[model samples]
Target chain A: MNPPLSRRDVLRRLGFVAGMWWAARAEARDIPGDSVYQLRAQLTDQDGRSFELSSLRGQAVLVSMFYSSCEQVCPMIFETIRLTLLALPVADRERVRVMMISFDPARDSVAVLKATAEAHQCDARWALLRAEDAEVRRIAAVLGVQYRRLASGEFNHSSAIELLDTEGRIAARTGTLGAADPGFVKAVRKALSRQA
Target chain B: MALEIVRRATRIVVCAAAACGTAMAADFITVPGGRFASVLPQGPVPTVSVPVEVAAFAMRATPVTAGEFLAFVRAHPEWQRGRAPAIFADRRYLVDWRSPVLLADGGAADRPVINVSWFAARAYCESERARLPTWLEWEYTAAADETRRDARADPQWRRRILSWYERPATTSPPRVGGAPNVFGVSDLHGVVWEWVDDFNALFIAGDSRVQGDPDTAKFCGAGALSVIDRDSYAVLMRIALLSSLSAADTTGSLGFRCVRPGGERP
Candidate 1:
């Protein structure tokens, strides 16, 4: 807003400005709960309750998004999670929780999530939670879940297993939704190791 | 007195042995493997209408060998070897053909072939003037074993199949089990899924009889009685299972055994 700065003044400020831009660009996503970290968002879930992204504060949360009706990738994803969990020694399984969030609010109700859970025969440790439309989208955006519905009422979404450490910052993510085998397993293992 | 006694004993023994052999042949198929249900598909045998004529001979034992399927593949060039179609792989690549078909101990030609497709198989059968045995014909043979105590039934069969499933992946050749059926068929199971004609012809809708049930209404339809010999608990599996995959499909699992028509069995 001021008159054009003198050549000396502009030159004098360039390094400082350049340094601040670099710092911002290279900023590490905060490991939440740290003083340097700030909670950026929150959402209300189906139970009329709210799940603050910050709630996954301390444990490594592997959040997976899926709808009950998926035919192609859901089963593989479920099995991958199963193998990953089973690959963990029983002791390690106790520390980790695989949170499966349902993305299709129109049809994926609580009952549907439970049915899907049963269909896969997942054990009690796996939590299948369904959120309302707004909450699903908001939380999905918060977690960077990329998803779109196909014409068949099925979803063509990224089958990514997102790793959030106890502090609730994204630790790592990998695997296309269609990976047939334990690609997600590799990602989860890498993330857990990173956390350690 | 010694010669008279020997002659008398020999006649008795010969008569008894012949009777035993006859009884055994009448009860040819062996149900050595699963406690799982057998299918009693009774649909129209478009190819072989005369039921129980043993229109097709069952495999003496399951075929979990590469040699067996290789014969089928070699005979049928039209069947795309690696990319067997989706209709064959259950709409997914469940069959990993490249994984391994050879057994740990090596090969057995007599073993039934696994990891083959209906398309490849149909060609093989056609070349020989024999087609894949319909589900009904297979059931007819299996029932003989079921009734005569010639076959191991129930709990034992279940264990046998499960055991095959648990075998090391590297141990490709399916182990042989279950005595041969009357027609000299071997290892019908405890190896891989056998192919049958008219698989999806009779669908098992959950509430088939109900208004909401699928069109055929459960396992009891016009086609139901045709496919099933009786409503045995295990038979439902064959009737209900829809494994009609296309030729381009390849699976680590799944294979087939060849059958010759009654008049055709060599």
Candidate 2:
């Protein structure tokens, strides 16, 4: 019978294995410790273009989660974003992008997302996105957005707009709706001005 | 010298094979799903109560052990303690482990793996072709005792479960196997707080919006969870704890299990 392996020997072997694995895989650039972009969630936009959430890096982004069917606060989220952007200078607003991900991917298809975008008059800078249920959950988790599907087919969700800095770090968040949150707008302006 | 080199190479190969071979051998017991009266309402209105329809699923009979997690990190090096991204896990993640791939001692292997972030737990489950159980599924399965499937109604049973919460924290918890519930699951309580797939979805009781409270204004749409059963203090405490955590946050007493779909409904 073979001799029993010691802890040192096992660790040595494991270290070698790990070393080989890391060597074989190309190391990606380091994202900030607090950056939400570290979450590699696959998302599809209103245009049906599939992209990773991290691809939105290099721009101050306003991110939120809402289902298109939500009549009350979901629409208000769009209006609030618009109002928040309006509060910023046009140049700063041009640099800032909005990412609205739907937690209800089952019903929020590409066509549905596009229509919602049109209804909200969302321009090219705004991305109305949908992801798989698990991905949606992870995105929500990272953004601190809470949402759950109800029996009535409507979603019971927290409406918080998170501001991701140029590096995708959460710089500011606001849950106020029906109008722009002044503090959140100030944070957005600060984020954009810093990036500028 | 040649013979010694050959033995070392042979040992490495054998050790690698053994670790990879046993990684996926966890025991999964089926918990039949049905209409469950969850503490958190399934409606937009916090006060209104509704039953959630949970599908049948298979769950790990016990929480993921440290030994099992060691094998997992060996297979998927990206999820190792130091290698995992900071956005996915906080500094306390897997802090108890002596090394990224080694448990502190032999006894550490059998103890339920704690200080694991929700993201890390979810990754481990994904590697096994399973996912973390939903809050509803976990609550439903945990409501069972050794004899009855829904022993939550009994005051003595509630007290017994609550006592686990009251006990002082043990730095070295015992091995995972305990009395199995009606679903053949063990250590759902008195072991560790677990990570649910929808942990972030659990809105807290304090999320109730007040007219002038700025912090309360942070949530839209009946975001607060109005507890339907206040008597289930143990279960309600679990909800509160889970609702308070972020995806990257990990605590010493928190661990998790995985669940697969298509379990036979009883």
List each candidate's DockQ score: 0.01, 0.37
User: Which candidate has the highest lDDT of all?
Assistant: 2
| TM-score for each model | 0.36, 0.86
Tens-place lDDT digits, model 2, residues B1-266? 99999999999778766644448467889887787878777765566667767788899999999888888888889889888888889998889888898898878988999999999999998887789999989999999999887898899999999999889998856689999999999999999999999998787665334323323345555445667777899998999899889899999999999998877321
Report the C-alpha lDDT of model 1 over B1-266, residue by residue, as the tens digit: 99999999999778756643211111223223322223432224211223223333434334434554544454443343433433222333324344333322344453444455454555455544445565655555455443342343555655544565566654354455566645455555445566664332333324323323322211111212222223343444444443323332334445554455443332
- Give lDDT tens digits, candidate 2, residues A68-130: 888767888899999999988787878889999997899999999999999999999999999
After superposing candidate 1 on the true structure, give the runs of residues whose Cα lies further than 4 Å from its correct spot: A1-196, B1-64, B72-77, B80-112, B144-173, B208-234, B243-250
lDDT tens readout by residue for model 1, A1-196: 8798998998879978999888766543333222112423343343334555445455566677777887656676787667667766575666676677777877976667767888898675566776655345445544545454433455545566666665565666656333423555555555566555
What is the alpha-carbon interface RMSD for each candidate? 19.7, 2.5
Q: What is the interface RMSD of candidate 1, in Å?
A: 19.7
Chain A of candidate 2 gets a TM-score of 0.84
Pairs that collide in candidate 2 are none
On TM-score, the candidate that comes out on top is 2
Q: Which regions of candidate 2 fall more than 4 Å away from where they truly are?
A: A1-27, A194-196, B1-24, B43-48, B207-217, B264-266
